[model samples]
Target: MRTITLCSGKGGVGKTLLATSLGRIIQRQEKCNVLLVDLDLSVRGLTLLAFQNKYELDRLPFSLTDYFYLEDEDQPALLHDLHKGLAQNNSNAEESQETTAQATAGPSPYERLDGLFILPSSTESERPDWTPLHHLELNETIDKLGKLYEFATSSLHVDYVIFDTQAGLGSLSLAATTLSDMNLIVLEEDDISWRTALNALMEISALNKRLQQKSHSYFLANKVSSSMLDTADKLKAFSFLPPIPFDAWVQKLFAHATTAVLEKDFEQSDFFKQVESRVWQELAVILGARQRTTGNGPRSSWWRG
Candidate 1:
């Protein structure tokens, strides 16, 4: 399985939105099982998005917080429980009366997505106790998470494991970055966003160098305006995702905590279509879902150029 983490240097830059949308895209296009883990302990936005009109956090039986504090020997059991819970939930949802094609019919880009699941962080966990790195040694926390990753990929058999991590270069964020196979640093089109994102990109680079592990990394510029695309294009050295332009419709969805990718007419929208054309294509290439031609023959790579 391929593991990707979406992180940023600053909050409110749309990392969770990108992670959710990208997960939907990967699940639909690749026809694979995708697991999204929200590691943004301070803000549980993914949880809010997933169960927005369905269930509230207080009603859920468990959350990722339970896994974080478990002993190493005990974590595997918690992981298994989470996996089983999700499987049961998916099965139950499928057994629910199916909506006719007409009911679901839409040009929505993500309407066809399936086999996607989200494990949201616990709202019960206080902010003071959120960062595992602060409570434990960084290397120890990284090792524990690495082992969890191994179990998820090997035993769970998920095709894609995407993590929505907290912003900044905090210890947890750094550990998550180290554990991820690919890191997507998200930012907006403004100068503050650029400045913060540059710092994030450099931190990732330095961490990779220190770890001596080469994982694919890229910068995603969001909320781009038509006038800013030219200026955005001038940002050097890093690969980019298809910049999501500022749209009033998107703002409304965000305000309502709605999943725009799953909404009607998403396929007909320029924003999501651009996402498919640019981000999906790049993701496919990175995850080996598509073959790349080279002098040696067709091969797969995480590098986007």
Candidate 2:
């Protein structure tokens, strides 16, 4: 399975949003299983979005926090339990409830969507205990994550493993970067964002060189206004994915909605259209998806676009 990590040097640049939207788009378009691993231990943005239904959030059997604290010998069993929990939850969701309206409400919050699975950061009531993570060695963290990666790919048969990492160059973010086939460094158009992004790029480059890894890295400018397109183009050190245009509707939706991708009119928005038509297509090619043909025959690559 190919792994991709979405990271940012700063917060609120839309890493979690991009990760979820990209996973949903790829899973639907490619007809393949995609697992989104929430590695943001502190914020847990993906976890919050995935478990919008409080029942599902409280019922989750295991999470990344639990996995990290477990002994190596017992860790794999937690994943097994996690898999069973997901299946059981989906099955239970199909059963009837007390209210007629509830019975006909369709799939539960945690029900499998096509083939999109989310491995949440934590299932804690208020906040996850991140103390243990700070004590573990960096390599130890990466090793544990590697095992999780193996299970997701071999046992779960996931085609893609997308990591939603913590903002900045934290241990979790670095670990995720080490394992990814591609790292998308998300940034805004502000000067601080750009400077931090450059620092992040340099760090990733140094890490890859030290480990002799060949992971590809790119810039993904988020919340770009029409006025900032020229500014974004000036970032020439690393290749860039198509910029996600600023959408006020999306920003508002994110504040009140569980996930922007699930909003009623989200798919009709220019943001979603750009992500579907441009971003995913570029990502699919990089992930080695076979070229697809449309009514107009094969489409051109991102460079041509």
Worst 10 residues of 1 by lDDT: 102-111
Q: Each candidate's lDDT (Cα)?
A: 0.66, 0.74
lDDT per residue for candidate 1 within 59-166, as digits (tens), equals: 454466666676768875676554444434242222323212112322211112457767767744235544543455677767866766675544334778888988
* C-alpha RMSD by candidate, in order: 7.3, 6.6
lDDT of 1 at 43: 72
For residue 13, model 2's alpha carbon misses the true position, in angstroms, by 0.3
Candidate 2 — which residues are off by over 4 angstroms? 86-112, 128-132, 233-237, 290-305
Q: Against the hidden reference, what TM-scores do the models get?
A: 0.78, 0.83
Off by over 4 Å in 1: 53-56, 59-61, 71-77, 87-113, 123-136, 234-238, 259-261, 264-268, 292-305
Model 2 C-alpha lDDT per residue in residues 1-305, reported as the tens digit of each score: 78899988889999998888888788878877788889987788889887777676777778888888777788767876664544433432223342222232333333346678888888864753346366657788878888777755543556788999888877778888889988888999888888888788888888888888878788899999999876665543337877888988778888788565655477777778888987777667666785644334333322210
State in Å the error of residue 202, model 1.
1.9
